[model samples]
Target: MKASAGSSSMLSHIAYFAIIILLISFVPAERLGNAEEALILIGFLGAWRYSWASVNFARAIYFRRFAYPREKERAVKDYASRPGAAHAYFLTTSYKIEPEVTIPVYTSVFTAAAKSKGGATIVSSVVDGADERLIRQVFSCMPCDMSGVKLIIDRIPGTGKRDALAKALSLISRNCPSSSDVVVFVDGDSCVPANIVDQAAPFFTNPQVGALTTDEAVDIPQPGFFRDWFKLRFDQRQIMMCSMGLSKRVLTLTGRMSVFRADLATNPDFIKLIRSDFIDHWRLGRVNFLTGDDKSTWYWLLKNGYEMVYLPDVRSVSMETQPKPTFFGSAIALMVRWFGNMLRTNGRALEIPSRRIGLFVWWSIFDQNLSIWTTLAGPLSAITAAIFFDPIVLPAYFAWVMFTRYMFCAMISLFRGHWFPVSYPFLLYFGQLVGAAVKSFVYFRLDRQKWTRQAAKGGQKAPRSTSERLKSYGSIYLHVLALGWLSLAVLYLTGAA
Candidate 1:
């Protein structure tokens, strides 16, 4: 069956390519020149957005055969039993996290910490310490005695995640001074597995490894389009992260959970970076970043030449609940915050010395800035060409999209231990179109954002200052004008306008 599916996938790819070639070859000579130009331009735009991910996808497929079982698991166990196994400390931050999610997340981490030779400390941050008290209650109910672990509930003044994390990091750094100690950052809604420590902590034995992150899967008890959508995102995330791990560099140390050497996490400089990291935008000037603390940490490690590792064997399950009732609204809210973080930090992350980041990693960072436009380019260009040149163009483009995305989904599921869902194609288009739109909005409105998960009463200042609001409005219209001009030019030059 596996061989049959693989063969069918290959045949589909061949058929798709053949159709594209036929379409290009059969155009009339008079129209051929314009068609060829349009094809070249469309092809390049498509490949520009896809080529790097394809390369990473290929690398991931290659690494899976040897790396899947993760030979390092036994080594991790041996390392943990060793006399001086690094002391483990956890910094978990919460803001309005549901009780069901928070309880299991703490239970898993604390249960694992109890078995460790070294004691662990949990510095949990909460809004009113109400949930923090609930955490203490949950810790007390652990099936086994957790004498080795201690909990410190830190109540923040209703600030955002950055402040909560900053407070936790500062407290841990002061308390756990040893360079050998390892501090793991966990989200209140993330449920880690029992062997997470045994699998993750051993990597720190390598003195140069500044941080380690694990693979994460999402759990959505109530099933629907949103649930399926979240699952697909995690699936793609797994593939991309595993690919980066092969090179010992990851795009981001996901905020869901990541482990860092105590020295790095505790450094006053690192804390300051997390608290107030920002980049000097050409138009915006020193734009203070409000989100993506994980990116800030990852950039600091990269710039400083600290090696980061991704442990695919250690899986964490994040409990995902849609904040808004409607899927579209909820997804947009999430994307604005997410893309805002990525764009705000893109400038500096790319500037890290090339030699330190390597060619592929550097190109990936550069592509993040370009992809928003490139991914959106195809649809917009195809629509314009179809309206002016030929109606067949749109149908052909849609066919290509369905075929290619289906194959891409199949390939991603090759190493995954589960079946790929049928809803993936829909989710893929949604992500491309909707995600791109959100990125474009945040690209210009860099200073405009808020924590989507935070309560409205948190009383954080609004981002609608007169100057900022005007700039955001101007930026949106300016981009629209530019896009309109570009589309018309493409159509005219290709004889389609």
Candidate 2:
């Protein structure tokens, strides 16, 4: 697949350059007016995406290079000198993750718990006795002073993460953590630094800050579609996260690893929201949340006017697996779930006052709603211009896409992903174009929900009736049709079509 995509890109570059050479050599300046007009439209539409990405990449650099280091220095110093620091609770839920992955994950938790010094708790919510035994064995093998560490195991029916986490939160609240104590939520397949508690707990020393999520790097079993795709996506996530962190707020408290004040984590209202989150959509009507427990946590913090921090320097390793070995199927499945969660929560999040969340944060949420249509404008404009204006518009648009997308991949190489990914340009374009369409599909039918990784609890929705299915199909078609009309109308008014 990589070879095929590389070959296709090479052929496209050759064709694009050849056309440019032929046109510049033989075509008269006056006669090239149509192509010039079409090229202007393409560039104008592309400016939106390029500008957004450039600003975000720059903000991320500022956060990582200049801003976060000072915050870390202060936090670390304050932590080292403090006498009576609070407890650290490492709470993780394992449903059916493999033992190979789960072992190191729990080992890291045990190690961190021992490092906390002021006594810590490890809450593991598992389904079976075998898993409980496996966790105990892993805990026993830890080479550290675990006398200060206490392990609590909860047996849960393998329902989903929401239920498991809510149960664990209830258990922690029972212990009644002190004002300064913190709870760390770790996924069963993630390994945190042994000093994660020491590093993150200090940030909570500030009374205004409520939660924080750190940077993540992937640990793949082997190289394949999964590794590259995950890297590309994480690179994007890293940039956006750092950008948001500069605001003293992040979009989502990633479930892979997030730290919250024990007081807020113990709040019954907070735990209840995660367990039973629902949005009353105008069309869909009271859509229940199945996945996206992370979004729920973030929303609770944001609405309550609590400051959330992002620690770019502190990192965790995610042990990722192929949801479906095939790249297309797995990538699409994830985009659906991921975007569905964002689309569901972002609207309600937007309802919060700008004064409450800050102006930039408010506008960023607004952009999330606007970007879906804006992302489609460039391609749809190229098509409209080609039909109504000139055929050469097609080649100009194709050449522009090849140049711009590759430029984007190159620029982001400063962050996480590989510097020289063979098919990155194509993959980036595929993700954007197809991802936009998927967002549109899910936007209209918000009731459609699933988890790509958890096979047992995936697709929790009941079967739809025939008439209900037709209504969904009709809603999606009309929304798409409206988008097409809007794009055409814009291009025509601009005299590009």
- Candidate 2: give the clashing pairs: none
Instruction: Please write out the lDDT profile of model 1 over residues 1-497, one tens digit for every residue.
Output: 98998787567666756766676555444653445656667787777657777888877765555663463664476576678766788888888777788788888888867865677788888886678788889988898878888888998887677888888898987785576778888888887777666667777767778998988888899878889888888888888887877777888898989989898899988999899887776665567777789998998898888878877767888888897989999999899888888887777777776788787788777887778777777787777666666656665677668767877777777767775656677688889888987887778767666777765321123435876656666777877886777667677755665
Model 1 spans with C-alpha error above 4 angstroms: 1-36, 47-50, 67-82, 456-466
Winning candidate number (lDDT): 2
The TM-score that candidate 2 achieves is 0.90
lDDT of 2 by residue, 1-497 (tens): 99997888678766755755664455345544665655565677678768877888899899888998988888778777777877998899887788899898888889889999678998999987888999999888888878998899999987888999999999999999976899999998999898888788888877889999988889987877667778777777788999999999899898999999999998999999988999986766678899999999999999999999998778999998878768788888888888888988999999999999998888888887777777777777777766766766565566567677778877788675456465667777888888888888777777778877666443224436875666576676878787878776657754765
Poorly placed runs, candidate 2 (over 4 Å) = 1-32, 35-38, 416-418, 455-467, 470-474, 490-497
TM-score of each: 0.88, 0.90
TM-score of 1: 0.88
Single out the weakest 10-residue window by summed lDDT for candidate 1.
455-464
Error of 1 at 15 (Å): 18
